[model samples]
Target: MLDLIIRQGRVDDEGPLADIGVRDGRIDQVAPAVREEARRELHAGGKVVIPGLIEPHIHPDKAFLEQKMPNRSGTLEEAIRNTAALKARYTAEDVRERAERVLEWAVRRGTTTLRAHPDVDPIEKLMGVEALLALRQAYADVLDLQIVAFPQEGIIKAPGTEELMREAIRLGADAVGGCPYNEAGITETRRHIDICFRLAAQHGLPIDMHVDFADDVDDPRYTTAEYIARKTIAEGYQGRVSLGHVTTLGAVAPEARASLFELLAQAGISIVMLPATDLHLSGRKDRRTVRRGLAPAKELLAAGVNVAISSNNIRNAFTPFGLADMLQIGLLLCHTAHMGSPGEQMAVLRMATVNAARAIGIGDVYGLAAGRQADLLVLDTERVADVLVDQPDRLYVVKRGQVTVTTHRTVEVHRGPGTRSGERPAAGPSRQADRIREGGVPR
Candidate 1:
């Protein structure tokens, strides 16, 4: 017997209809039919089943820190300053409460895994890091949270930031983070990168950074991220480095952009695009023909560099919107980048699922297939295009073989073609079997 069985659902990647059976928190069987009874059966006759989505970049710490002093001005610098002001008053309990709320929203929206960055500024007493670590422990079963010890306020520009980053890593942070462009100078930025690499190698953690979010074209210090990528590859740490929000790369000259792309691709550095935050934080100074200020997603994808999109900050100091929905982000990408073709849409879908998983170094533990954990979502849609266009409600969310959230679909009654005298259609196997044989549609 199985713990749960999803009946007649269309599997992702355009596969045939099958019943997915789960037992002991793993996908036990996926076939045309399962004879054994199940404790619970979800009827998904006209729906689609897909693997749970993963968001690789987010700021749960900023969510907690910005509760009191929200960003009024929409500029990136104003958001940073406001967050700094708010971080001064943060406490462990306060951070935990607010971060928990954001995680709950993520869970309800079909995101089971996330990589959240926590601020490591020393003057704020590292309250953001402390709060996220505590919350990660508290919600271990429901969510797989990886905390990035991020120096949001530049690693070298802020006082004692390097020591605080080390302190956060020692406290069980999963990765090392930095903002190279925001540092004082190229030398300082290179110093910060060296510190991150040293800590990551010593602790066996990954490196994720807010690389370059500015749009200044003449700045030479913007190339520190490429330097870090090259050094990481030379030291034999390929695929363990990720660059977040490289917006300035989009604003650089064509020759410079090509060179940067070549270096990143050769160094195996993944790029993360934050659509929600970039739209809000960038291009504030341009009066006419404002730039999108986002990284070149299409170009990066074409160059064989792994690129993924994220929600970044949700109702936090950076942006007061963003609701943890990557589908919405995908739609925005389609509009902003003019990726309206069928193949391009499929690529973006993969970005939200497979590519994001690879960005955070958790691809093996994800996806919908045999030998994988039974974490899946059943949506009330027939095809991938329909799911993205309609944004239907999730009918069932199965996590580790248990039904985490289930919403029933309402059925309506209709008169048969040849009904007579208040008599209903036959309800025996003959009628049911005939309907099945004829491939009857669900009511």
Candidate 2:
């Protein structure tokens, strides 16, 4: 007997309907009709079924800290300073509570995998890592949590951060993270990147870093993409590195930018675009016609470079608004990055699924096909192309063939007799049935 079966689901926007069979926590089969029975079954009713969403980068431990200390200047500097003050008072219980809230929001929104970059600095010490280690085990059934020991404070600028990062890895961090642009100068920035690469190589782990997060490359520290690319090639770390918020790349001269893109492609490094935080904290100095602080996503994809999108921060000083929804962030990118065409829109969706899986080093086993792990979503929309435009509800969130989250929402319009268009009806209480969820039917 199979574990579960999803019937009459459309996996493609222009393909025929299919049935998916799940058994032993993996997709057993997918065909025009699954010819076997299962202990439990779901009727998709011709709705679009997609692979589960993935968040390649996020800060769960420091999430929801806007209320504690706000960024009054709305600049990256103020955000960091404000967060640093708040981190000194962080407790295990406090971090756990806020982090759990973020996870619950993510699961309800159909996210099955997340890579959390918890701060590994002097103030927080190992508090964030310890809290997330427990969460990694507790939420294993519903989510695949990959924790990175992110040194938000520069390794050289902040004394003892390097030792603390090692301790975080010893406590079971999945990746070694860096913040090179936070250093005092370009020289320290290079040393910071060197230490991150050495740590990753020593431990046989992947590297994910925050680099070039400014409005322009006028600062030498923000222009380290080329240097990092060369280092990646020399160290033979191809396809094992990811860089977040390369916003400075967009400001580089056209001639230089093209060459940088080629170098990045040759290095096989993935670019994880943090649209929420990048758009929020960047371009602070611009006055008239402010620039959109974002990496050239369209050009990066055209250059044969792997690119993905992530939320990065939620309700924190860095990004004061987010619901932990990848689709919402994709739509935001579509608007800001000029990815509104049909094909471009589809690409944006992929950034949250397959592309993101590749960024977090889970591409081999994450997808919506037979032999892949049964991590998928049955969306409320009927067409795959409409998934982003409609912002439909995730009717069922399946993790390892088990239904972990289910959402049932309905809406009905009621009209009284003799109520004509452009005419006012009786002012009595009208009986209109509407069960709204998450901003009332997405429009």
Candidate 3:
């Protein structure tokens, strides 16, 4: 017998209604109707079912620190300095508590995976990594958490951070991370990138660098994105290197941006757009004319580059606001990136789902397909087009064939004026109300 079966569900938001059978924590069959018997049956009632989305980038250790240390300056430098102060007081327990709260929100909102970049600098020492490492085990069933040993303070400038980053990987980090922009100067920043690549090569891990994270394309600080893209090809890290933030691409000369896009596509590098943090921390130095420091998603997609959007932070000094919701991220991205048409809206959806899963190298086993891991979201909306507009109630969240988070909401409908519901008194007994049946129920 199948472990679970979900029927009358909509896939791709608009495809033909499909029924999925799950067994042994994997999707067993997908068809218009699944007739086999099952131990448990979930009636979607024509709800929308989609692959569980992914948050390709986030900093769980630094999450929820906005209250403790606020960044009044609202600049990247100030955020880093203030966060370092908060990190100093961090203990294993402290980090885990905050991280757990964030995870609870993410999973409840239908995010089944996250790439958590926990700092590994000397000031924070190993406290953040240790907390997230344990969280990886604790939430393994709920979250496919990928930890990155992020040298947020810069490996070269911080001196001992390189060792700490390596140690973090040894202690269970899944990937190597770096904030090359946080380095002292162009030379130090270049060297920091070299060190990150070297470490990833040594440990055979993927590289996810925070590169080109400024708003002023003319500034010399926006130096590492092209360098990282070129080096990715030289070091044979294609398809394994991801760059986060990349906000400066918007301000660069169109020709230069075009060249960079080509290089990124050639290297198979992924661009993870972090709108929450980038739009806040970046462009802070610009006074005369402020720039909207967000990645050029439309241009990058036009160039055939892999692009995805993520919530880089939540209630941290860097972002100050977030709820770990990818649809919210996509909707905001649509506004910032000017992607509002029907096709653009759907493309933004892919940014949070398929593109996100691929950014973290989890696409193969992470979709609403037969034989894939049973991670899915069932929304109360019948059409995929209304999923975002309605932000439909999430009826069911299935992870590994086991129902995880389920929410049910009820709406009271007044049938007619004579029914005296009075919820909408302005139009008491309209012709629409005449459609109500004799039992005061809408037909």
Candidate 4:
């Protein structure tokens, strides 16, 4: 007997049909046949079953303030000003309510885990972390919420922030974070990052930073990514650090990019690309050629660095649009980063699922293989390729051997001339399945 069984599902719209068995909140077997009795069974009906998504970067404290105070110009500076004003008036109840709305949507969109960055400077006074901590515990059964004590306003620039960040970790934040570019200069920015490193080491937690989010990446002083990569190696925190919104990595001088990518790979650091927010808030000053504000994903991937995508904000000033969907983020990445081929599509999906998990050090415990946690999404589509274009039904979402969310899709062609909505005649598998080869539905 098993806790639950998922019947006749495909991994990525390819390969032979297989069944997944779950017992004790973990995947027990994944094979062509698993004839086992269980407390519950989900008839996948040939839908694609994927591991639950992970959100690597977000600001739960400043989510959904699009209408409260608007940034007329979608520039980064204006966003910071607008959000600072909003954060000043932030209450625990308000933050909790907004963060809950975003988290609920993310969960419904197939995210089982997320890393939320809440402001921890003196102005916010740890209110954001406190609210998210409470919400984390409340949603523990369904969502794994990890909070980052982020100094969004800068530490040296806003003296006394280091102390608050220390308190934030003591209050249950899982990681240390910083926005060093918000400081006075690159010199102070280095100190800002050093302070975060010291804190992460002090509290024994991972570090996630917001670095080098500029439209143009040429700087005579220094780029934050290079300094941070060097620091990761110096502090012996390789593989334990992630950088979010490093758009400058994409904009840097072409000659400089390769060296920086090699340095990042050497340090075993991960990059979380915020497509929605970065695309919106960047290049305000460029009228001739608008900047795309994206990292060099292809170059980074080729350099053997772990590059992931994330929904950074939900309807906030930083990003006036988002629904907490990693697929949506990945779709935007596919367009902006020119990842249109079938192999690229699989890589894009992995950015949201596997790479995001590795960013937070949860890859070993997450995924669809045997012995991994049973966090899966049975999407309602003939093949996995439709997941991005069709927004297909989320037939079932199983978390840890238990079903958490489920839905179905129904359509009809009304028997019109040459209409073909129903399954094809005498189909062992749809002809469309022919295109779905090597774990993909080829274009």
lDDT of each: 0.77, 0.91, 0.83, 0.85
Candidate 1 lDDT, 1-443, residue by residue in tens: 88988888877434478888888888888887878899989888958887777789988766744556777677887888887777777777777787778788777777778899878886565787788888788766667789898887877788888788888888889999878777778788888888788888998999999887877656656656578767978878888898888887787678776777877888878899988888888888888989888888888888778899888887876777777887777777877877676567667777777788889998776777667778888888876544555667777777787777766676556676875646656664421112111111210
Worst 10 residues of 2 by lDDT: 434-443
lDDT of 3: 0.83
- Choose the strongest candidate by lDDT: 2
TM-score rank, highest first? 2, 4, 3, 1
Clashes of each: 0, 0, 0, 0
Each model's TM-score, in the order given? 0.87, 0.94, 0.92, 0.93
- TM-score of the candidate numbered 2? 0.94
Candidate 4 wrongly placed segments (more than 4 Å) = 219-222, 409-443
Q: Return whichever of 2 and 3 wins on TM-score.
A: 2
All candidates in order of lDDT, best leading? 2, 4, 3, 1
Tell me model 1's lDDT, rounded to 2 decimals.
0.77
Between candidates 1 and 4, which one is better according to TM-score?
Answer: 4
State candidate 1's TM-score.
Answer: 0.87
lDDT of 2 by residue, 1-443 (tens): 99999999978754578899999999999888988999999999999899899999999999999988888989999999999999999999999999989989999999999999999999999999999899989999999999999999889999999999999999999999999999999999999999999999999999999999999878999989999999999999999999999999899899887888999999999999999999998878899888889999999999888899999999999999999999999999999999887678788888899889999998889888789999989999876777788899999999999999999886655677876645655676642322212111110
